[model samples]
Target: MTAGETVRGLLELTRPINVIAASVLTFIGAFVAGGVTTEPFAVAAAVAATGVAVGAGNAINDYFDREIDRINQPERAIPRGAVSPRGALGFSLVLFAGAVVLALTLPVAAIAIAAINLIALVAYTEFFKGLPGLGNALVAYLVGSTFLFGAAAVGNMGPAVMLFVLAAIATLTREIIKDVEDITGDREEGLNTLPIAIGERRALQLAAGLLVVAVIASPVPYVLEYFGSVYLVVVVPADAIMLYAAIESFEDPTAGQSHLKYGMFLASLAFIVGRLAVTVPNAL
Candidate 1:
């Protein structure tokens, strides 16, 4: 493949929106850690490095789960022949190496956190991804780590840890909803997703309950006096909207459309609220 083709294939494999989300979380973590020396370039390199790791993990997922993607996501790059398995694997390997190199240039704490993230990503693709609730939990942990990684990059770990926990809870809830969305494809492939193993109604109930918890917990940081009213004003409505979307998704789990919609909505809300919360303390 030519350079442009390879770059395009890598971007397709990573899904740019998700890459942006990962970068945003890293920036949020950094901001919450009190390291935003400049608004534009604040931890930009760290965010880009995290993006590489995130993209690499996504590409590796495509490589290992090509068969599953063929069935569940035929339009994906691998199944659609936009990228071959070998090509995707090569892209993934290079990105993974780049992530490590980027981490090495960051602080000691950032490097350590990035190393852990890289290991977790590999483990997820290699082993944990198929292991029932454990897979969901592991994914949540890694998602939560981005926030701490942001804080670690700037040498401030306190508030970032708190945000990390909140993000983990929200992510786990969303992951359950995702499994419900893909239950049919998973069942067809004999892959044991949460919905298939636990039953759809129960799984929906669990996801809904977790989402409610996360939404309610969304404003606790502000209520606890860790942040000013800016977070309360911004995040309260954001969580309410997310709660509605989660309910809708729980009600209809038949298609990827609803799941994707709800998942994107929930993620957007969380991101907005989390970033705003990080700023509220600073504004005050």
Candidate 2:
């Protein structure tokens, strides 16, 4: 393959799009914990660490799912034969180690969080992901933890827990939808994902229900007077997006899976903006 093809293969192995979302979570965590303003250097380092960790996780997931991908995603780096499983695994190891090392330089809390994340990522990819709700819940935790990790870096847990809970539920909603999307390949590959353990239609119903919970919870921060009108404005629309996605997923999980991602992204963005709306004026 040409150099361009090689570069594209590496990018695909990292799942760069997912990495962007994870990195943003790390930033949001720090920002929220510090209450509108956090230590920039430490937050930046944490963001970098998050990006590396997410990339590693994606690469390792692809390494483990190579055979499954041959059916679910033939164009992926490993399944397409552009990158070897061992190569992906080694790259993932390097990325994981780098993220840990960076986090270690921050504080004891950051180091501890990094270690836990590393352990969870490895365990989830290797074993937990094939289980039913357990795997799905673990993934949701990981998503929310990115923000918590940021907050913890500054030695402030604060209201990050609430945000973490919101993120976790939203992520769970999307993950289940994704499982519905991949039910065919997962069943053929003998994976025990929720949809496989239950039934696709049942899984869809559960995902939709869970998403409704998240939507209802979306306005809590505003209603509690923790945020201003800006938060309510943005989050309402974000919640609407999620509700619409949930309804669609119930109707057609495969297609619903695609739209749910956009809804989740918008929700995260709303959180970030809401925080900014409150904090930016205070900072000035």
Candidate 3:
């Protein structure tokens, strides 16, 4: 591959969009904890650590999933020969090192969270992926932990706790839907995902049920006075969309999962807007 191609492949291996999204989530955590202004440096370190850790996790996942990708995702970097497995592994290690260095600069609580997340990320593919709901839960916790990590960086984790719970439930729902979407490949590879362990319809039903709980609890931030009225305005529609996606997954798992992601992103925006409205009274 040309140098440019190699660089692009490396970037692709990191799943830059996911890294950015995760970083944003971490920042939102800090923002919600009312520390974005007072603890700017700590927030930056936490966000950077989250992004690097997510990139490292993705790259490592790709490296371990190279063989599966050849069948399930032939267009992926390693499957398509855009990047070698060894290169991906090495790159992931470097990213992990960077994440560790950044995390070490944060508070003790944040450091503890980061250590757990880093270990979980590394162990996920090999040790957890083949399990049923265990793998999905692990992934959900990792995603949700960003909020806790960010809040911890600023020494205030109470406000971010709700966000973490909401995000984790939503992520768990999506992961199960994604497993349904990938059931064929998972079965072929002899990996027992949620959909493989339970029937696809049952798995999707469980996903929808879990999302129902999340939607019911979604308004708690506003009720707890953590956010403002604008949060309700945005979160209501986001919740509606997520509910629709869960229903849609029964028919088209791919489309359902994609829509769920969009809805979740919208929900996250609600948190941001709500937090902003509270912090800046006249902004909304």
Best TM-score goes to which candidate? 3
Looking at model 3, residue 156 earns an lDDT score of 99
Lowest summed lDDT window (length 10), candidate 2: 32-41
* C-alpha TM-score for every candidate: 0.87, 0.94, 0.99
What's the CA error at residue 264 for candidate 3, in Å?
0.6
| TM-score attained by model 1 | 0.87
Q: CA lDDT of 37 in candidate 2? A: 52
lDDT of 3: 0.95
Q: Which candidate is the best by lDDT?
A: 3
User: What is the per-residue lDDT of model 1 for residues 62-132, given as tens digits with 9 covering 90 to 100?
Assistant: 89888878887898888877788998999899999998887887789888989888988878856876667
Candidate 2 residue-wise lDDT, 184-241, digit = tens: 8888888899988889878878888888888888888777655556777777777787
Which pairs, if any, clash in model 1? Answer: none
What is the Cα-based TM-score of model 3?
0.99
The residue-level lDDT of candidate 2 at 122 comes to 84
Say which prediction, candidate 2 or candidate 3, comes out ahead on lDDT.
Answer: 3
lDDT at 218 for candidate 1? 69
